[model samples]
Target: MWRQVALEAFPDAGIREPIGASALAEAELRLGRSLPTELKQLLLESNGVIGRTHVDTVWTVDQIVEQNLFFWSDESLARLYMSFDAFLFFGDNGGGDQFAFVQKPERADVFVWEHESDSRRWVANDLRDYLGRSLSAGGDDWYQ
Candidate 1:
């Protein structure tokens, strides 16, 4: 379902191979939280989609781990973690901007973390809604 939405958004995009069950399990262990059902389903279907607008790449499980580690280790970037420690980044805009799932019990909403401002804003209610808006956003005016 998410793949179809992505393809509709960027017909030229390609879906990556599905991540192994062991790898997914390892990621959950590392994250210390169960991946959202929609997220896991999307990954199992396609590790990530390439060549989409707004979110240019849906990061693979390994990429997720590496990116999180890189940002969490940095002094400046790590500052945001103090306030929003529950965030789990999963994609990038290819312009240093990141998208993540805010692991709150009430709702794991999607948020965009702007690299320039070091700020995060709620973007969508969930994975499916995020995919729809991302694909539908024309040009670079993603917020519009």
Candidate 2:
């Protein structure tokens, strides 16, 4: 149904194959935390959602693991921005900003991390809202 949700927003939204439970388990192990329930459900329905201009509205599990690990551990990023240990990044604006769930507090709400200023702010109420907002829009910076 998640794929349908995306398609409803943008008929051209690209859908990928659903990820298996084992891959999700490994992803959680690598992140050292469980995936958000809504996000997990979405991924199981469709591994990722490609939005306008081919942006990853929802990333695949592998991308999720790699991006989060990089944001949490990269020394260069650590120096440039606030620590990312509290965020589980899931998508990008195709510019430099990224979208994420609050991991430290484990909230369903989604936030945007504006890359240049290192600012994080509320964007969508939840994963479904995020898909609708991002996919239905016409640009990468649609959240803005």
Candidate 3:
């Protein structure tokens, strides 16, 4: 379903193979949080997709954890960089900005972590809504 939505919404997207359950589990273990169901379903259909306008790529599960740690631990970055304790980083905008699933106990929404402002803003209700918005967004206007 996610694959179909992706292809239908963005025909030029580069899709990769689905990842195994163990790999997903390992990522969750490393992050110490469970993956969102919508994201898991999307990954199970296709590990990641590339070639979006605003977002360069939807990172694979392993890359999600790695990128999260890289941002969380990089002291050289702006002091405004947020801790990974509160979000599950998942995708990148090719810029320093990141897309994540909000991990707060009451909210499991999707947000964009702006690199320049070091601020986060809710962008979608969940993974499905995010994919729909970003994929259908005609150009970089999605960012603004």
The Cα local distance difference test for each model comes to 0.74, 0.91, 0.75
Candidate 1 off by > 4 Å:
53-55, 79-84
CA lDDT, candidate 3, residue 136? 74
Better of 1 and 2 by TM-score: 2
Q: How well is each residue in 66-132 modelled by candidate 3, as lDDT tens digits?
A: 8777766777653555565677788766767778887766365888888777788888787777777
Cα RMSD (angstroms) for every candidate in the order listed:
2.5, 0.8, 2.1
Query: Which residue pairs come into collision in candidate 1?
Result: none
* TM-scores for every candidate against the unseen true structure: 0.82, 0.97, 0.86
- State the displacement of the C-alpha of residue 77, model 3, in Å, after optimal TM-score superposition: 4.1
Across 6-103, the per-residue lDDT of candidate 2 in tens digits comes to 89999999999998899899999998999998889889988988899988888899999999999999999988888999999999988989999998
Descending-lDDT candidate ranking: 2, 3, 1
Backbone N/Cα/C clashes per model: 0, 0, 0
Q: Considering lDDT, which of the candidate structures 1 and 3 is the better prediction for this target?
A: 3
Q: Candidate 3, which segments miss by more than 4 Å at Cα?
A: 53-55
Q: Model 1 over residues 1-144: C-alpha lDDT tens digits?
A: 767877776676678888888888998888666777788888888897665543445788888877776665678655555544567788877777788887765366888988677778888888877776666566433743
Q: How close is candidate 3 to the true structure, as a TM-score?
A: 0.86
How well does candidate 3 score on lDDT at residue 43? 87
lDDT of 1 at 2: 68
